[model samples]
Target: MTDDTPAGRSPSRRTLLKAGLGAAALPFASPAVHAAARDVKISMQRSSVLFTVLKVKGTLAERLAPLGFTPTWHLFTSVIEPMNAGAVDIHADVADAVPIFTQSARAPLTFFARERGSPAAEAIIVPADSPIRTVGDLKGRTVGVSRGSGSHYVLAAALKRAGLSFDDIRPAYLQAPEGAAAFEQGSLDAWSIWDPFLAFAEAKRPVRAIANGTGLTSYHRYYLVNDSFVAAHPKVVATVYQALVEAGQWVKANPEAAVALLTPVWGDLPPAVVAAANARRTYQVEPVERAQLGEQQAIADTFLEAKLIPRRIDATDVRIWTPPAVKG
Candidate 1:
């Protein structure tokens, strides 16, 4: 009301209430009801070509821009520690068994996307000149591997297939780089590792593959998200998945370009090394199928039989992100 309409009397309660509400709705509104939306934090493994491309091409951020998502990429060599500490919202191109092992520690992770395993990429490598010819020869010898990795299971499975177990070999649990150095220094008799490392070593040195994943393990890689992130943001999960799937297809069609894109990000490794690594991988991303997770169950059982995981996990019983239907 104007000052002329109210000399010494205050405005009506209804008028005051309306004015208050309008003022509150104005541009200078109170700080948001919740914290400002933060950029989606994604964890990328150094050797994950699809994620490397995503970061290099800067397309994921553009795809998510309309929704106000700033994609923040964090480079990591492994995800367990980051997942445990909740450092990233999502992790892509992780070994299928890695998440299962994380589950044993009770990390709430959801399976979101998958890339079929290529056994050729994950192998047990020994020096070409080494006399250890068969899996059985691995008995009582020093084998370097990173604990809780896909190769961890591979070492155990290969030994088991040869009528042995982890106990049969002296396990040297070391990261790929460290293991590479050790293996080069003649400290390790053999190294069980996955692609990029497997690919790099083979190309740069005189290493021979004792065995690959074919009969032993599928070596499937998966995209995982912290349970809380997917629960709070389903659409965000879909966006990430679609981006990865497309990127995977691009990598499959353009292996050389994939390597070129990944080289700089991967510390300028040789183009041939990157291409070989990409060649050894099946970059075809697909939806997570519950019925087809028998291998996952197998991985869980393998870990359990070897006392790697604390308990048997169904592997298929975790939260899975179903992509939203495409709009017409």
Candidate 2:
């Protein structure tokens, strides 16, 4: 896999391994005994630090071992397209707005888990010396943002709150690394992005956030699975969900340990920056509920209004998988 580092620098093999470019197939039961164990392919992103922790700890693999399955992790910079195409069985997590775009494409996917809202985790930022002090100042300025990312919605909502519209700005659709490069090179007037990247930029450069998704959006992240995977391996899905819940609890209870484990995998980000980014995320994994989809619907509507999505869609129309109840 290619390195995600900005500025066209190549990553060493060791760094790539640490960054999870090499698929991690955790050991199951005795090799001789479970030689035929099925592989449960899981896709992970650097921002989803909980999955990084779990992958490093082999937590999901351990949990699925008894079910005759071994966990294999594949790192990804963007997960929606691969997920929709059935390239991965489970998507670690993605911004709230991602699933909406996937659903609009009629992808057969199901929401299994979500992190509670951490609205401040994402923001619209400008260089410290830039004259764009407020969201209204963004009108007609070039803004760098990932197309269909949660930060995209953050920019749109922030603009609307300031009485501006999506069409008022010139958008540079870019991934995190490219956006950072452009923003630092003075090519972009502003950038809309989420943490670790957000935290990393602040540490390396002078920037200021003009607005984040506070009242505008909850910024909840969601985990999804291809519907075919759910049908073929319901029990495995349940086990993975339970593992995520426990992993979330573990990360919250042991922040320092989580940071230490994640720093290397996240491109050796400083421990402090990793902690700051983690601080902005709730990481409280919970089952996706229909009632909680209000923000999702709002996101879909906003994207539709902005003409970012191809067509209108009912955000709650997708399938949801509920975990089994906990035993006393």
Highest lDDT model number: 2
Candidate 2 weakest lDDT stretch, 10 residues? 24-33
lDDT of 2 by residue, 1-328 (tens): 1113433233576776646643333221222237888888787765767777777887776788889998777766666677668787887588888998889888889999899999998989999999989999998999999887899889888887788897888999887778878888899999998887788778778889998889889988899998998988989989888888888899889999988987777667778888988899888989888988988999999889888888989998889988877322
TM-score of each: 0.86, 0.91
**Candidate 1 Cα misplacement greater than 4 A, ranges:** 1-37, 326-328
Candidate 2 vs. true structure, TM-score: 0.91
Report the error of model 2 at residue 288, Å.
1.1
lDDT of 1 by residue, 101-122 (tens): 7777778788888888788878
Candidate of highest TM-score: 2
Cα lDDT for residue 189, candidate 1: 94
Judge candidate 1 against the unseen true structure and give its global Cα lDDT, from 0 to 1.
Answer: 0.73
User: Every model's Cα RMSD, please?
Assistant: 17.5, 3.5
